[model samples]
Target: MSWTLTEEHLADLARGAALLGTGGGGDPHVGQLLVRQAIREHGPVLVLDPTEVADDALVIPTAQMGAPTVVFEKLPAGTEPVAALRALEYHLDRTADATMPIECGGINSMIPLLVGALTGLPVVDADGMGRAFPELQMETFSVYGVPGSPMAIAGEGGETVVIDTRADNARMEWLARGVTVRLGGVAHIAEYAMSGADVRRTAIPRTLSLALSVGRAIREARQANTDPVARLAEVLADTLYGHLRVLFRGKVVDVERRTEAGFARGRARVAAMGGATGQLELVFQNEHLVALVDGEVRCVVPDLVCVLDAEQAEPITTESLRYGQRVTVVGISTPELMRSPQALATFGPAAFGLPYAFRPVEELVPA
Candidate 1:
């Protein structure tokens, strides 16, 4: 089913996208404000079902690329994504029929929506990654065979750089990352241009709707004085992401974080409450990559490692984590498409340089 995305839905969308972002994908607050501004000016943007898109329609995926922490001081000028889209279209010598998110988590989730509203293009409900990943090539669209080039990156100052890495997706990330660094550690991107048929085949479907639902569920649960984490799990049970496990509940004891190589790299230790034994240690590069409980791997990408405020159930981003905050670490299984051998090689534990093999979160933390 298709729907219109209005400013009214931005809050819930951001909240849910932050959770699915798994502590990466740029800051949700920034993304939400950007989308809200665009929608207020251009009216509600239409969100089309992937099946509704014509086979030959040109679908261009757009997102912001940077360390989430950098976005705090380097706010978008609200024209970057549109600038990137126009540049890419000028390069391809063709207009895009629609815009879609490269990743459905964090600020990237809202970039395409901003583009759609600004340009009067419909937004596709699907995305390249059901959850966020640090690198450009980690998208399922690339893993499933879409080339991520003839891409464009745009800065707040209206500078646009077009890169065509041909068939080398990793090279695209290399070049884009270098350019992003030069552009002051942040830029908006339009890449992985493909036909609607390609989107239907490779894109993670209905993730925007899923995010909105999850966010709304949290809000409604809080209003009703019910357990929001339990509501979040219930809301996710029917989605492509099948399970949500609260692996640890505790107070953040320590956080060692730094911005390096245009990415946020860090470790966070959460100790069990009430003087219980064990600690949940999170190691991340932009997004949470692994969760270790007393040195045992409990959750690893491409599965989600989400940390939520224990009482409010609000998802916390890596850049926002602070010592002494009470957090509930939840692990969510990725969609089946993300668990395939090819997808795993692209973004699994091995891809992140972790020692463990890819394991479903449900199996890792049995109910």
Candidate 2:
């Protein structure tokens, strides 16, 4: 079925996208603003389902690759994706049947939508990862054996890089990241060539619908004067391995940031509230990578850790976590699809150079 996205849907899309980001997608606010602005300047975005594309259709997933922090600081030249896609298309000797998102998180969620609206292509309703992760290779496309390069990266400065390297996904990530860093730490990227059949097999199906449900639940709960968090928890109960835990409710006490290997690595400490009057610390790389309660590891990657404003219930991206802001900590288990042995080996703490063993969030969180 075809759908036209309107201004009324942007908020829901953002909220839903945040929930799906699973604590790793960059802040969705920037992308939402970009989409809103584009809609005002252009018009509503046209969305199409995977089935709408021809079996032989060349589908491309488009997104921004960089430090989320840098994205906010270095605004786009407003033509990166279009420029990159056009260039990549010219090189491929073909045009895209439809454009889709690599993942649904922060800016990535809305980027393809905006690109589609401007370029007059239908934005596919599916995505590679239902939630976001730090590296490009973490996508389902990679897991399903799709190539990452022969890809395109476009800078706001009109610099474009198209590498047709036959490198593995991990190597491709290293190469692409190096190029992005040289381009001033961020660039728009479009990659993952796949037929409609491959897309349907690997991509997360009905993700937009899931996002819409999540967003609608929060909105309806607020209108009914119910706890939005609780509403969200209920909606996601089945997929979550454990009950939602309100880890902490407090004001940000401190923030420390450093860049490592082109990633924004940092820690945020929050002064606790109510009965738990103390502190909680969160360590992050691009997205909230880990959570510690009073110096004890509470949740780690391969599990979802997120921070949200106590009042707004909006997600607080790792890049945006700061001092003096009141926020609540939330932890949910990663979906089974993402917690497989192979998946864990790739994203687990050991993968990040940490000493912790991989454990299910259900075993980690207190019952």
> lDDT of all the models against the reference?
0.93, 0.78
Best by lDDT: 1
In model 1, the Cα lDDT at residue 68 comes to: 89
Candidate 1 residue-pair clash tally = 0
Best prediction by TM-score: 1
- What would you estimate as the lDDT of candidate 2? 0.78
lDDT of 1 by residue, 9-123 (tens): 9999999999999999988888788778888888999999999999999999999998889999999899999999999999999999999999999998899998988999999
Off by over 4 Å in 2: 22-24, 51-53, 238-243, 275-278
What TM-score fits each model?
0.99, 0.91
